[model samples]
Target: MQIKANNPDEYIAQIPEDRIPYFKKLRQTILDNIPKGFEEQMSYGMIGYVVPKSLYPDGYHCDTNLPLPFTNIASQKNFIALYHSGIYASPEILDWFVAEYPKHCKRKLDMGKSCIRFKKAEEIPFDLIAELMQKLTVKNWIKIYEQTIKK
Candidate 1:
């Protein structure tokens, strides 16, 4: 679902009430695990963690006015979606996550290039996600982005 919100709080408030606790926990997990320098804000209609302009002055290449998005979380119609640019940009991280997913989650991973979809709240693997969050620091992400995604 597309939620139009000014901030992360507003975004979570619009998600299904029943999933509030889970989303809150998931959000907290990211906040606690993601490396320092990534700022939380409303990004692309979801809760996002980004490298602020102060760190990467160029910001997102697609839009210089915005920060460089590192990750995002959103409550979709059928699942909770996590978008991690690191996995998309770094093959090593993707391979690590792919190999480790089965150990943490019973369901086969439902994923796209960068989006990990958890169809049920109980199926989400917070611990694995936390580890994934720590794999990429702001400097590492920017370096990867510049080398691979920025063009």
Candidate 2:
């Protein structure tokens, strides 16, 4: 579905009727576990929660303004996507997710970076997903971000 959200609120409102429930649940999951020093906004036509440059001015890649640690949630044509930089930055977290939630094997997890896709709401491991979300909050993300910046 097409999302015409120019801002975060509009983005949340623009979610297609069919995908509203899933989107809402996912949105709430992220909001409920939001970390400190992070700002929520709309980026790449999706709902993105980011760690501002002030906290890590050089957080982005290639000197870009994009924040190093963030999560992006989007409503795709056939599925919903939840993107988190945390997974790619923390092997321990990613490994635990893959090991504890093999049921998600059918789901598309873009480990290449940090995007995880689910074709349906039922496909998502809500509890596990929330756990990861909490672990990846701005505070924890900074620690990982620092390690990454050094390398």
Candidate 3:
């Protein structure tokens, strides 16, 4: 579940031992695909990727001192959650993910506007996840974020 931790390593360490490698693989995939200018940290009791304040001084609209959140991966009680702001902000990307998900995954995509939930590690559509991670850069996300706030 939402085990609060002081940092990313601590947050990851809180994962169930048996599930460590599974989460690690997901984490590594995100790391490999994440564009430059994003930083990884512990945010909202989960592992988060964000656009640092150094690059965007306005920071997150919710809290000006905090970075703009891009995505997050969390180990939950019944499932693991992957949250991506890009998919939530862009209908085209969301549609693309929905249409392509079945091609790569056997399970139904348990999802919300931004959060994709996986009941088991095998249920994760990693290729799609990686592709989505790669698609959103800091500059692109900032543009989307600004548009969203305006709306």
Candidate 4:
């Protein structure tokens, strides 16, 4: 199915009927936890919750318009993915997450310099993830973003 949702509502409406619930839950988790600066948009054909350019101009790898230190929630053919850049950028937080949610880390996390990919929505520990998300406040995120921009 071609999901071409323009706005947040439309984007969500395009989600496969069967996966709507999962997507909604994930979306709510991100919405409830992140700060006000974050923007939700369609990115890479998936619902991406980003910390807009004004907040992190050099997103991930200098993509000014893209948001960094954010999460990308995508609905795939068989499962959902909750991609967290913080997992890669901050080892301390990642380690804490792993230690706290061992069951979710049974499989090796597919990570980059700034992303953690989960195959299923159930794999994500919402409460802990929420806590971790909160840790990346605007103040702290800006400091980290600035440091990364320098390099």
Question: Against the unseen true structure, what C-alpha lDDT does each candidate score?
Answer: 0.95, 0.74, 0.88, 0.67
Q: Per model, how many backbone clashes are there?
A: 0, 0, 0, 0
Off by over 4 Å in 3: none
Best-fitting candidate, scored by lDDT: 1
Model 3 lDDT tens row, 2-113: 6989887787788888678778889999999999999999887789999998999999888888888999999998888999998899988899899999999988889998
- Ranked by TM-score, the better of candidates 1 and 4 is 1
Backbone clashes (count) for model 3 = 0
After the best TM-score superposition of candidate 2, give how far the Cα of residue 129 lies from its true spot, in angstroms: 1.5
Model 2: weakest 10-residue lDDT segment is: 103-112
Candidate 1, residues 66-148, lDDT tens digits: the string is 99999999999999999999989999999999999999999999999999998888778999999999998899999999999
User: Model 2 off-target regions past 4 Å?
Assistant: 103-112, 149-151
Per-residue lDDT, model 4, residue 43, is 74
Better of 2 and 4 by TM-score: 2
Clashing pairs in 4: none
lDDT head-to-head 1 vs 2, winner: 1
Give the distance in Å from residue 137's predicted Cα in candidate 1 to where it truly belongs: 0.8
Q: Which wins on TM-score, candidate 3 or candidate 4?
A: 3
Better of 1 and 3 by lDDT: 1
Report the number of the highest-TM-score candidate: 1
Q: Tell me the tens digit of each residue's lDDT in model 2 across 1-151.
A: 6687888678767666777777888888888777677887877678888878788787666456777547888887877888887777788888887786766456555444677778766667777778877776566787787777545
